[model samples]
Target: MRILGIDPGLNTTGYGVLEINDRKLRLVEAGIIRSKPSGTLSERIQEIYDGVTEAIDSLKPEVLALEKLYAHYDRPTTAILMGHARGVICLAAAEHGIEVEDYAATQVKKTLTGNGRAPKTQMQLAIQHELNLANLPEPADVADALAIAFCHYCVWRGQRVANQSADP
Candidate 1:
């Protein structure tokens, strides 16, 4: 199964593709969709929408995983942009007939690092180790994207096991 994990942002939306089989993972691709800050809000959103749509087309993933937004009092503008990014992401997935799952930040970190409040570096290191990568994936955005993918893999595997046991 192939999964596409997205870290949404108006400035740089990050994405990572992972192929999984028998609990093993292989990184297919990882990158960010950058939008120029000089543009109007509408133009930036359009750029993000177009970039993410192109990624979905190229990857053709079986599942889509999105990092859920966690609010902070100091960053209302960040929260608003995050919402915009998420809107475009949902639209792209829906248009492609892909089921999207939104995982809370804690859920993803716990699944990856065994701790809900694990630091970003810990999550990044753990993901690198779990995926058997020699070096860390750069630009925290990419790391977060990969962690989202890993979280889905772990959760999906658990669900599959339960279903198999429930069946005759």
Candidate 2:
């Protein structure tokens, strides 16, 4: 299966593509969709939509594993802004007929590092080790996106095995 993981943000939306075969993962491509701060809010949102749509068109992922947004009571504005970006990301997936899997940030972190509270640097290092890349994927968002993809792959692969044993 080919999976695309998204870490959506209004200014900088991150994406990572992965191919999973026989429960093993291979990195395809990873990068980000950036919106200009100078643009209006709607413009930023449109940027996210267009960029994500283009990525989905090119990468053609079977599933989009997106990070589910969690709102901190104290940071309602931040949460709302992130929701807008998340909407565009999911819309792109829907337009492409891609299945969507939502995972919590903590879930991805725990799946990658055995600690739900793992720090950003820890996530980056873990992803670097997992992909065996010569350099760590940077700016943190890219690594988070990859970790989300890896978590989705792990769950999907396990479910496949369980379903097989349950059949006949």
Give the winner by lDDT: 2
Q: Mind giving the per-residue lDDT tens digits that candidate 1 earns over 1-168?
A: 999999888788889999987767899999999999999988999998998899989999988999876787898888987898889889999999999987999999999888999998898799889888889888889899989988998899899999999999
Candidate 2 lDDT over 1-168, as tens digits, reads 799998888888889999977767899999989999999999999999998898888988999998876887999999998888888788888888898999988899999999999999999999999988899998788998899998998899889889999999
Every model's TM-score: 0.94, 0.95
The most accurate candidate by TM-score is: 2
What is the overall TM-score of model 1 with all chains considered together? 0.94
Score each candidate by Cα lDDT: 0.89, 0.90
